[model samples]
Target chain A: MDTEPALFSILRQGQVLVASVHTALDDSQLLRLQRDLVGRVGTDRARGIIIDVAALDVLDSFGSKTLRDIAEIARLRGALTVIVGIQPDVAQAMVELGIGTGAVATALDLEEGMAHLAAALGPAWTP
Target chain B: MPGLTYDAGVGAAVVDSGADGPPEPSAAELHLLVTRVVRARVGNHPAAEDLVQETVARVLAASDRIDGGIEAYAVTTARNVIATMWRDEARFQRYQPRMVDLDEPDAPDMGVLAGEDQVAVRRALESLSVQERSLLLAHEVDGTSLATLAAREGTTAGALGAQLRRLRARMRAEYLIVASHREPPTERCRPVLVAVALRDQRRWREAGVDDHLAGCDFCADVAGPLLESSQQDSGRVAIDVAKDHDVVEARVAVRRLAADLGFDRSDVTLVATVVSEIARNIVKFAERGRMTFEPARSRPGIRIVARDRGPGIEDVELAMRDGYTTYGGLGLGLPGARRIMDEFDIESVPGRGTTITMTRYRKDTR
Candidate 1:
């Protein structure tokens, strides 16, 4: 109802489609965005989803677990998810909360994350 | 927002008596708002109620500003009142009595005082050297610090300081190592001991001992007990392993005792492995066995003595050999246990029983 509480933008690097999430992406919003990205890419070609959480000040257990779940689901859908901008305190809190972030590939910033995703997806993965 | 009533009798009071002004929040609304405010402030219900009542009284005095959103206004007012109450409570606690005399001579307070005395003794001994410990004992206990220590040890102020520093560092290190092994120390102790040991170790080797002693408090607390236990004779543990369950229990018990002795997890694992093999042998060959966990006198290690009343092995030399086993597998238990442990001894009679005594020194001790 509130436009799903987050902003989503799609960018293209010569047919390589990258869905960039630029707001506080919670569980439901993440799921919705994933579905929308999968629909846009049509599953025939590989796609990359880059979740930018730079604006987030707090990352509780539910948020971290949801991100992990999103990564797993994206892999199953033949799309790779790169989570970026995890702050040090948020990482520490996640460890203290016993939230396992082992599944997802994390990067310092969105640019690096995109680079990593691009490298993992290879040159032919471009749409 | 305009249907409000003013009660001039209750010290400049304002009440939202207007029919449209949210119907003047009911008793239930007031109770819920106050309860939330109190819980957030004091963390206890009864104390929260007292603070809430005070806030309500304050609100009643200045109720003239009662507007449309009365619930939000009441919550803000309650928060301010609780904040003021907390400050006053903290101020009162600051000047509270440190000691209370309850007229009884021998009570729990005396035990508290004894605890305080122990702390004081530890604090005093914390900065003394082994020489200083001996010196203090000689001076205070034997009344010989003035001229006798000076004559016997050639005591000068500078020499005394150096000796005291060394002594203090050793005791501190030993205390710290023992403390660190049990549980991580508090934030305050960790930094202080770290600074002291780091600075002291730069000058002396004994001072460096503090860094190694940084973990287990159980070992630190029982250092004296361990020494006393080692000094005493005729204190041997007798183990009887007559059943399979006994073997398992003995292995678990030895592992636990190793932990109680403040052995690190790796050492505990090794000892547990050796004890398991020995225990299994007793069950398979001897039918029954017993094991004892004792402190070794000559060495800084734990001695595990296991015995079984079964058909004893005919060849002691063959059993000690690395690949010699009648019960299959790699047959590395006896030899492996011997190699891993510091000392190992096995004694078996042809048809009576066998006793194997093994000792594993603590890591720091080794």
Candidate 2:
């Protein structure tokens, strides 16, 4: 049997919501992630959302599209979304595959992404 | 579009020569005839019904009395319309000659089910015991490592490997028996495994195993998927990149194609990125071009070819450099694309055109 990790883990950094995805997900998991994030955004009252994909090894077309869609959905709920921690190989692959992550803002790492989110959320957010 | 194969003049001569010509077909009859004509040529394409409606409109517009039968007249008009559409489409083609070889090797028969054969495999798999099914699924679909499985089963890795081999042979034997409905000699059962393992290997040809597979129903049933799967593995998608929006269409097609070919998420994104880069180049440097996505013949990967008949590259080496760009790009398009794919090649002739071919293989599949 293929052992699957938890689809994603959510951390609350003040008003910011950081989702650290650790597994390469199939369609069902992506849908679950979308639904979970949307629901969490409502209850958590997050002003900003940072998706950390540092542990992810790949980001196929479907995965890329799902991320884009997740960002769009979060934006609709009035939270700024930033995708951080794209590996070098993953970034190169993304460029070669012609899948532009144009919809979501991307950062090099979690810290940079959180900084961007902190700036966007304003003086209330220090971390 | 190589879609239309109908011989437009099939029944026209008979209608023209028949004395007093056949009775004029009614509007409803004409609609049916034109629909059949278009469908026969183009199958159930989205444009088929529209072509039939246009044919009906044309028939309505004809003021002069028809000499031949209405069926023949409508058929001729439909053919003319289809031909004109093809001609117009041909004019928009920007790729010179359209296709460049990506090294097509004789595909091996690996007992992988494809198309209708998949149904047979599915039924055969259902007949397997739960444990046997799980073993196969864990190894093949789930991609569980042999070492890990061996550790879990409390057996040496070598023993597990041998056990798996035996299980595969038995499973394939049962699959063959179930699929072909033939009871072969007991000796023939083990040969099925040998036949499957060598299906893609060149040695199978020298050993006369392919010929054996051709004659043996059991072997053929087990190997049918290999034949069709390899065929499906190779395909080309040509996208016309004349406008910025067309790039999206091209990207969508590439992404779908990559996904269908069973590329992992990272690889799919890589394919999409390469396709987009080439397509964006078409929009930028050439103003128009074609991007083709095909399978790499020698390995488990996709081959992408981007060709344009615009002003060719002046410096090949400069274009490949990380920050080099003729059209003020970020200078990373070609280099980034090259870095992502497993193999990359480019050819260009000044004033003629350019062709960039790249391939990305699945590492885990290898």
DockQ of 1: 0.01
Candidate 2 lDDT, B143-192, residue by residue in tens: 99989888887888888777676566556545655566556644754455
lDDT for B169 in candidate 2 is: 51
| Reference-based lDDT, residue A16, model 2 | 81
lDDT of 1 by residue, B1-366 (tens): 443343434433344366543467544456567678778767875677777767666655555566456677778988888778778878878856645675667876889877766665675575566666777667556766455566677667567655555555455544654443444344434333433443432432343222222222333343333223432442433345555445546655676677777887656656765676677687778765556677677755788877665678899888878767785534656776777678888888887777787898998998
Angstrom error at residue A62, model 1: 44
Root-mean-square deviation per candidate: 25.5, 29.5
What C-alpha lDDT, on a 0 to 100 scale, does residue B354 get in candidate 2?
Answer: 78
* Model 1 spans with C-alpha error above 4 angstroms: A1-127, B1-239
- How close to the true structure is residue B205 of candidate 1, measured as C-alpha lDDT? 30
- Flag regions of model 2 displaced more than 4 Å: A1-5, A124-127, B1-194, B197-200, B203-366
